[model samples]
Target: MGWNPFRRAPLLHVANDVGSGPVVVFIHGIASSSITWTNVIPLLAPGHRCITIDLLGFGGSPAPLDAQYTLPEHVAALARTIRSLRLREPFVLVGHSMGGLIAPRYAARHPGGCGGSCS
Candidate 1:
């Protein structure tokens, strides 16, 4: 799909596009942002288009001034990002640390559309 920008309520950040191929979205750990994957993007760039994003309240992304970082909130933001990106085709999702939990929840909510192979 072409590059498109989107934002969900309570989340304030733009998901940037890098490279081109099958989409690979990375969800960072708690307290971290998309930049956390800077070191690894190059390695994956050759095979897939990687999209790293800052979750609400972290990195360049904006967080609710009075919002608490809860699992549900994080998952909601993630779902919106995926839909907005229009990744109708099944894409590989890589999550790290706390992302491990959040990613699975997202996959579960979306069913066969997403698959999680966590460590």
Candidate 2:
């Protein structure tokens, strides 16, 4: 298939964004989706803004035919999503398994983008 100039770029899916307070971004592990934080979010939502994402090619997010789904690709998609949120403060990043791998890389590439992290 040929690239179409008019085709809109794909975007990652934000599975859930609950609560309102300090931000807490959650990234799921491989073969998993934002659902991973279902139980946890409810616990933290009262005190923190819980933002859960479905990584590229997972959950509600797109999986472009041209995408390689590499670590960089995943991080890039994540970066775009984070930027779109237009956050006022650095978010606390939390991940599980593969998401654990991604969280640090994201922090390393975009210093100050994350105020803290857990995996």
Candidate 3:
């Protein structure tokens, strides 16, 4: 909805990046953004690299005119975002509410890409 000042241009969809260990991806619920994990991220950050996502059209990610916001579309956008990050290994996926529904679908589609449980 607004310009993202958190991360760089392309990675605006992602939230924080802290600590140095295994990765943990967080997907917020409908109508929410990565900020949903503000409290939780710090706890995990101590032992992991926290990467929260702003689902398409929510949070800091832009909402384009041509993109139809759907479950598939959302997942695809997320995939693109993750690919751009170029992480060294698979990550743990965590979601809340609608995001909870989306995470498993992403995990199912990319089985090997997910190293940990989709919580």
Candidate 4:
């Protein structure tokens, strides 16, 4: 079989999904994975839906050779993954380090897709 350009990699990997309420998505920094939020998620999970994801090329997410791992690419992958969740309402976004960089960009690009963010 040929290298199928149309066969794209799946969206970023979701590491954790807990609780039930307003949504909160956590993004880890460069050289990190969703596991970084281990202790934090519990505090928020009681009153909100807590979700953590591995950015593209990190943790459980695919690292395609063709990927440049740019800000746009990361935001694009994150948007796709969030869209896949079919969230009923806008959610809060939180990021650490490089993830802190990506979170705001994603919020800017997607608008109401993210109600608020912390970096």
Candidate 5:
């Protein structure tokens, strides 16, 4: 799949979605990408819909030098993506490190969205 980054947002965030079953979303730390779940996804893919996100300033996502990487901003971007995905069934969110820190706060703010958390 070839993509044109030229016309894309400077801080283009990405989410790799795969498989089909109960949803399980993974958010990696500031230092990682969706690749972080490469090992674990295969094990769980058969039974879960895995969606891993690349937060701002990390991974496949952009890290605009001018962008302010605040926790709230990151959370908001995540919330927007989740809403855009329109996942009707509540999902299990698993975040690592900084991502781990964001998960709980996100779950609390969007209580109706995240079914549970495994950080």
Candidate 6:
């Protein structure tokens, strides 16, 4: 595994490099960051490469003061992060809360990925 950077406008963050097989990107809810999945990462890291990012305006990622934090903005941010990381292979997306909505939109825009809503 190697280091990769993802940046878009006011957002910038890191994705962990782990495992040997496919990749699984996890998006945390509004007000949360990559560390939100800390407990789950250890379990999944051995088998699948996992990515957990701080959404723009949260945690380590920066936010645009002039921009609106809408659903579409989040979806676009997630997509940008994925592409910036150059993750071309099929991957699974797990998101929580508002992220649940953003993840499905991303998967819909980019097929072969799975995403669902959660409380």
Model 5 C-alpha lDDT versus the unseen true structure: 0.75
Residues 19-116, model 6: lDDT tens digits: 76788888888777878888998999889988887887787776776557776677766766676777656788889887798888887776745322
Local distance difference test, each candidate: 0.72, 0.83, 0.77, 0.85, 0.75, 0.71
Per-residue CA lDDT of candidate 5, range 1-119, in tens? 32323323343355678889999989998677888888988899888899988987777776665556777667766776677677878889999999998899889888886522222
For candidate 4, what is the total of clashing residue pairs? 0
RMSD of 2: 5.1
lDDT of 2 by residue, 1-119 (tens): 54333444456899898899999999999998999999999999999999999998999999898776777777777877887777778789998999998888988988968422211
Residue 87, model 1, lDDT: 62
Candidate 3: Cα lDDT at 13: 76
Point to the candidate with the largest lDDT: 4
Using TM-score as the yardstick, the better of models 4 and 6 is 4
lDDT of 3 by residue, 32-80 (tens): 8888999998788889998888998888898865555667677777776
Alpha-carbon TM-score of each model against the true structure? 0.79, 0.86, 0.82, 0.86, 0.80, 0.80
Cα deviation of 113 in candidate 5 (Å)? 1.3
The RMSD of every model to the true structure, in order and in angstroms, is: 7.9, 5.1, 7.0, 5.1, 7.6, 8.4
Measured by TM-score, how close is model 1 to the native structure? 0.79
Clashing pairs in 3: none
| Tens digit of per-residue lDDT, candidate 4, span 1-119 | 32233455359999999999989999999999999999999899999999999998999999887777888778878887887777878888999999999999988888877422212
- Steric clash count of candidate 1: 1
Please provide, for model 1 over 1-119, each residue's C-alpha lDDT reduced to its tens digit, 9 standing for 90 to 100.
32123434454365556787887888888878887798989998888888887786788876665556677777777776666676646777788888888888888887755323221
At residue 16, candidate 1 shows an lDDT of 58
Identify the runs in model 2 with alpha carbons over 4 angstroms from their true place.
1-9, 114-119
